[model samples]
Target: MLAHSEWKAAGEQLENQPVAGEQAALNQYAHLVRRVVAHMRSQVGVVADRDDLQQIGMMALLKSIRRYGRSLDEQFESYAFKSIRGAMLDEFRRLDWRSRQSRKEAHDFRDAVRELRRELGREPRDAEICVALKISERQLLNMRYLEQAEVVESFEMLLEQQTHFVDSNEDIEQLEVRQLMTQTLALLPERHRILLQLYYTHELNMKEIALTLGLTESRVCQLHKQSLQLLTEKLKG
Candidate 1:
């Protein structure tokens, strides 16, 4: 076992002799690898392999060691901890990016909502949205149609995007945002609410929703888009 005393000595040596410090840190490989595995398991759940996490974590750990400085305001462990976790998170994002929908269309939809709110001081009707965006109702509907087809994320996934203000730790901001969204969701029509529940809460695909709701897949898709459009405007208010 590498002692805390040894860790301190190696950290101090790193100031004068970086190679020696790096070798010393290697003596404590088990400790660093364990910390990395803990971070991976938290974000990715239990299926993650120890060897894979260890390999990624070691790369991050080495980078941290190389960049760490005695002149910094924080301790070596604190700095290295962030580096290791950030590395793992980047890998996780890369893997998940395949299915990750573009937040752009969703964001643009919200922006249009906000503009209507500012101009009208209330939830603008679809016609009003058409005027505010300077497009005809059919064009606006087309925009929504395209957005709906492009949207692969469910309501729950959207919620996840919103609440990610929570960061690495829980805070009052996360709680407040969640509470507000809960209220906003409740205000939606019963049928619209159900659509959100099936897609986001139940994590169902469009085909599954069509089967369960006894509607055609195209109808379900339209409903999904219409519901989000309504909710986005209402939330803006």
Candidate 2:
């Protein structure tokens, strides 16, 4: 919730020089944006920058403030929240579409490994694999990224069983907390969710994930950290 004084100041800024006054409004909006971004990061996963989210949110706030009519009969925060969140969601959707290829590659790699294991009596050596597949190291590495989600426990079996994750009571409770926090995540942009799922569920380290997703490793790491921090805080609560 914004302080009354903060709201009043933003309102005044909106009326004064809507465009030029945005800086002032943004200052106030930053607090609200941070709260929302923090909440979102916890639920889904960090795939977007808090600052980037904040900037988009500010744009949404400006849009709301500019279009808001005295007769709308809606609370300003309610209206602004929807607008700001929508903007961020829109951006997220765009990003999600872009990362689809990496996801497919990951899936295909898993399928290929399963098929190869089934055809061969024993795991093929790297040289035999090269002769059989005729793929370069880069291509193989790309496929390896796919296995991030499906780990082979013994690494010796032709068709390894999927590993089961047994969460501790604490982890289960924390997951519940994260679930509550990320309820709004489904409403977020697709890119944000996809990136988060890949980063968290796939458990791809930053560089590998980045290369797979065509993003900078640093950006991926930062988003990953931010997303984890958000989830931690929400679960703690």
Candidate 3:
């Protein structure tokens, strides 16, 4: 039975992976792994095998632990959530073709992307994907419907209930956009970055950020607007 503080420490340990504390680090994430597996089994249906998911999760945990940092100026949970979910989603996609009957062909396209990356060490270009999957532009465009439907539906669910935002890994396309946003934040001035972080990540109202920063609320609003404009430009670029 891990106490709240214990769990938090475990998270911290996992985040700051050191050679001396490797095993201890693994122990800390034990609970997170178990919880993810149980949640997947219960919520994601029996489409993917339990053992497979666990293995995928362990790989993800390792990646998270290795890449985890204490100083991205964001919550550790937010970063780990994406990594863990991504690993599981990768596994889910790999098993998708075998798990379903009617959608095998459509699912195979995604599976091909996964397999090719594993084999080729990078994602193939659109032409390469078409060649590998034996898919024409028309077929690829049609497949977008299936893919977009799932992405949009999941995004809607996340917006409706923020809790669901941390559930599964986001698709690769969405993940890129998210990474872009993080990079955009890094390019902004420290004040602008702090303002957005406090307002959005910390869920502080504008007034709260203003009070904490000792600025007028209107000034905070101005900074936020500038930050948004910069972020929007970076995203477009």
Candidate 4:
């Protein structure tokens, strides 16, 4: 909840020119964005800069402030929370889609894959798909960028799974999600499973996890990403 003075100041910023209170509000939300981005860095790939995500979240927070009004049913904080998170996720999706091939090209590739799979009676190899599509391997890999959602888990993958297990009308206290989570974690490789346990359950930072695993911090981060990706796949399956 925002303080009374904070709300008043935010309203003034919305009405005035120099964007009063924006800097202060953004400064406060900066911590919020960092937490969100840190959580997301594991879910999404670490390819994006942390600063890039922070900038997108700031933009969304500003937009939320601009659009907010008392006429709406929800409080400003609730609105802003959604705006900030949604903005970051939307930016991630935009980055993913920017490399998309044309609709015709995507469809052609999918058709080629289907045909080759039918002919082979099994999943077509990348080379077979390329030959069937009459495209080089590079082009096939490029097409993969457009089809990331098929191969890699999207950011909302965990959120969707949570919704399925913890609905408004469900039984059992809270062990349901934990049980599911444990089951999924167990499916990962031993190193990955240990890494997740060390970082998450133990609350160790990346640097600490790296030292514990006898790997570099950056390598630990990469392993974190791969582990989550594998866990997401297991959960979805």
lDDT of 4 by residue, 31-135 (tens): 656655654443334335677777777777766655664443445554565567667766766666333344466577667777888899997666676677788
lDDT of 1: 0.61
lDDT of 3 by residue, 1-237 (tens): 999999999997776554656455556665556556543331243345667677666667666666664433345555555566556765655565333542564476668768988888975555666788888755654453344324323442333332233445445445654565577679888887887677545646555666899975544544565565565555446
The residue pairs found clashing in candidate 2 are 42-230, 42-231, 46-227, 92-191, 96-191
Q: When superposed on Cα atoms, how far off is each prediction in RMSD?
A: 15.4, 15.8, 18.6, 11.0
lDDT tens string, model 1, 127-177? 677677788765655444445633422333454555545455433554655
Candidate 3 residues lying further than 4 Å off, grouped into runs, are 1-20, 42-45, 71-74, 98-237
TM-score against truth, every candidate:
0.35, 0.33, 0.35, 0.42
Worst 10 residues of 2 by lDDT: 152-161
List the candidate 1 regions with Cα displacement exceeding 4 Å: 1-146, 149-167, 170-178
As for candidate 1, its clashing pairs are none
List per-prediction Cα lDDT, in the order shown: 0.61, 0.52, 0.57, 0.61
Instruction: Say which prediction, candidate 2 or candidate 4, comes out ahead on lDDT.
Output: 4
Q: List the residue pairs that clash in candidate 4.
A: none
Could you tell me how far off, in angstroms, the CA of residue 140 lies in candidate 4 after the best superposition?
A: 21
Looking at candidate 4, what is the lDDT of residue 41? 42
